[model samples]
Target: MAFVTTFSTSLRSGEGSSICGSRPLSRPSQRKMVRIFMAQEEQLKRAEDRMKKTVETVKSNFNTVRTGRANASMLDRVVVPYYEVDTPLNQLASISIPSSTTIQIDPYDKSVLGDIERSLMEADLGMNPNSDGSVIRLIVPPLTQERRKEFVKSVKAIAEHGRVAVRNIRRDAIDKYKKAEKDGDMSKDESKTNQDLAQKLTDKYVKTIDGLASEKEKDILKV
Candidate 1:
């Protein structure tokens, strides 16, 4: 009975050691998988961030296009020469839309009013600046059919550029993973999976850009 009990005890000890040995072996592989996943996630996040920025840029550009109504954002691109340094128009003045078709600019410093007026004139926004010494007024005229069509075309071009930028970011992200696979940092299957994810992200952002463009086009075409 004693010998039989000793044999059973040895068997249980062997089993426990085997399990412990396997734990050490698996730990490295588990850690490696975690690292790989984190790297892929980081890459995807970076790509998405860039795509979002591109969309925002397209939105900002669309805002700069003149509509029939008075929008303060239409002067977003205007730069005034303040003390020999070029500055954004919004920084130098308080712009208000008191009416549907008039943009009023009130400068804190009256001395810079003339500079602001000249800058607005040079902006070529199809509006003349009427400055009465302390303030500048821009009368946003109703856009003709031809002018509206032109603005629509411009917004379309901007949307296309944004789409192209998103696609470029996707390509760059895919290339990074492919190179990782080539360097044996990841498997081909992993690289392919990441590439597919990048494509999906691109498609989503491109769709968003299209939507923004459609909205801008409608705004420009509205009488």
Candidate 2:
């Protein structure tokens, strides 16, 4: 009888300390906290990745938006007349902008000299090509009023494309947040907060695109 009572007293003392464990991390409450933190971190990483992709997309589309200044992208889509085959101007020749309104192209194949010049004139860049059998030069003329208006239209189209990209990013981020909530990794309230933050980021990027468009329009309008 004495042994049984002694064993019961020892069991009670062990249970009290083991259940309370001195370190908070060893407690069930703390385990839940750690799980919540991990879930939040995962969600944050996903959101950050989405934002990065959105930024890159914005940059790429912005380049295509066109500025009044000379830029490689301005000729990125220009095709050269290569010996009966169409080729990107960049591949067929070296294009250089010696001045604000001049672009020089030196073709690798001398035989296609005339063809390159013809293609440039056909590019509708509002410039004439000056060639001397080896190299071709393009003189970018000052934009006319009607030409500026047309360029503005092109700018608007590019801006709309950027807007679509930003909206797509927002949609993807929101979908991720919803998935996190469905997986029990996030509460509804937390998901809502993250979605709102993501939307704000989207707005910022959209504004950046708009600003680029405005600057480009002003430059194109400048005489």
Per-residue lDDT tens digits for candidate 1, residues 1-223, read 3433453354444432233355532444544545666677789899999999999999999999988899999999999999999999999999999999999999988999989999999999999999888899999999999999999999989999999999999999999999999988888988998899999999999999999999989988887
Error of 1 at 12 (Å): 25
Name the candidate that leads on lDDT.
Answer: 1
The all-Cα superposition gives candidate 1 an RMSD in Å to the true structure of 9.9
- Candidate 1 stretches with Cα past 4 Å from truth are 1-33
**Model 2 C-alpha lDDT per residue in residues 1-223, reported as the tens digit of each score:** 3433453444444433232456423345544544564555555556656656765665555555444566555666678656567788789888788887677788887777777777766767666789877787766666668878987888788778777877887787789879878988678987898788788877877887788778777877777
Residue runs of model 2 more than 4 Å from their true location after superposition = 1-71, 80-87, 111-115, 118-122
What's the C-alpha lDDT at position 207 in model 2?
Answer: 84
Q: Model 1 misses residue 1 by how many Å? A: 56
- Model 1: weakest 10-residue lDDT segment is 11-20
> Which lDDT values do the candidates have, in the order given?
0.87, 0.69
- Which candidate wins on TM-score? 1
